[model samples]
Target: MDMPRPYRSVLYIPASKERALDKARSLDVDAIIFDLEDAVTPDAKVEARDTLKAALKEGGYGARAKIIRLNGLDSAWGREDAEAMKDAEADAFLLPKVSSAADVEALAAIIGKDKDIWAMIETPMGVMKAEEIAAHPQMKGFVAGTNDLAKELNCRFRADRLPMITSLSMMLLAAKAHGIVAIDGVYNQFKDDEGLAAECAQGRDMGFEGKTLIHPAQVAVCNEAFSPSAEEIDLAERQIAAFEETEASGQGVAVVDGKIVENLHVETARKILALAEAVSAR
Candidate 1:
């Protein structure tokens, strides 16, 4: 399966801040979410939309994939946000609080079929209906909204993330079932480098394609977690070589370094190689 570019470190920038938008060009993030929602104040929504429009047209995001996170579908900013970014070179509309397939279809109608929809499954309803939400044809991915999820669930935040783990895992399963990407929520402790790395590792182990990042300081940690390690690439190459050598005989599985390699393992190896290529290009 071909993975879409891994947005392991998706940086959120308030669209109203012109300087921050300009500075993002030098950052090493995989994607940028120019916010028209939570990051911008109600009074600044219009200005932020304008800034995002101009920025995308001017190529402010550099090589990072650009996503415009619109306000909720019920809000006034949502429709206008889609309009302003309609012609802008945004990769997708990061639809906030999408609780069902209808919500995705609604955005798909506005954004058109070619442009994709990245849904934020933040609410209790969203978590309960994750599989249905991810079943949309144009749904490209799901980004976990743990902060909002905690708020909705009325749970206190903790390092263990026990309250949010089930919801997060549900998203990963749903995304995988539908062949869509699943990304973890941001680590709020931006200054705690070690803590952030641990959270990234946890997300990676849970099968998340990447993590939503809040600050530039978190970029390297997120990238490192999602990127293929040297050992992983080496193992992948060895598996491929082993499988190729037995192609004429057509064995059910190949063995490399005493480790059995199956077709499923080969798929994982291919994905790692693809990630390596994307990271190198970035």
Candidate 2:
């Protein structure tokens, strides 16, 4: 079945926070990730699960996708979370610390074909088997967990992200190869708007469809980063027009704004136009 691909801003909110859940219904984010894993304490897991179930029943996400990030499979509450969310009216079930294809298969067995599964590639083991994990037939997409990955690898965050760039890039490559959306990890420092913007730009350049956001403030930045700017849309239009002229068709390639534009460039332009339309509709 063809699934809706809302790979823009996936906003994570604690399942226990009724206020945040209520606010999320009105946000412009592509998805609302109701978190029942790391965000909820063990003592509150049951309560969070119940609250999320209730919210799901309320049905106010509008056009935005609805998702739930469950605890790792190894956790005590993982199975319970899956059971609770299997029919929670969510778009997908996010499995954290997805280390192997089996992890996804198990979740898929529970989720069945009704709900898609979004796997998190954060741990070293998960990174090592990202391709396999993403290859699962029921897998919908991937969300990079940069914070957990950095901690596991003991690497400091740098502008270049050299330490983990290979893993991050490989995750994106796997998702693309499997025809699934891939999202960059959340930027932890919400106060550093400049830094966050830079990372968002870098992620987009790295082939990420969008970004996982921690705060509502990060939504605007994520949306802007993944969106095609006015200048870019204009250039895409010119390139597409030039290509349709037939004069440039047999040329194999043509120069748009002094830059070589090819069939691949046209594909990218179409995606940009699609995103522009999606944004405009939203």
Q: What RMSD does model 1 have?
A: 1.8
For residues 134-207, what per-residue lDDT tens digits would candidate 1 score against the true structure?
Answer: 88888888999989999999998888888888888888889999998888999999999999989999988888
Backbone clashes in model 1, listed as residue pairs? none
Tell me the tens digit of each residue's lDDT in model 2 across 1-282.
Answer: 123355679889999989989999988898888999888888999899889888889988888888899997788999888887788888888999999999998887776865789999999999889889888878888999999999999999887788989889889889998999898998889888899899999999999989999999988888888888999899888878876664535655577778876778887787777778777777
Q: In angstroms, give how far residue 46 of model 1 lies from its true place.
A: 1.1
RMSD to native for every prediction?
1.8, 2.2
Clashes of each: 0, 0
Candidate 2 global Cα RMSD: 2.2
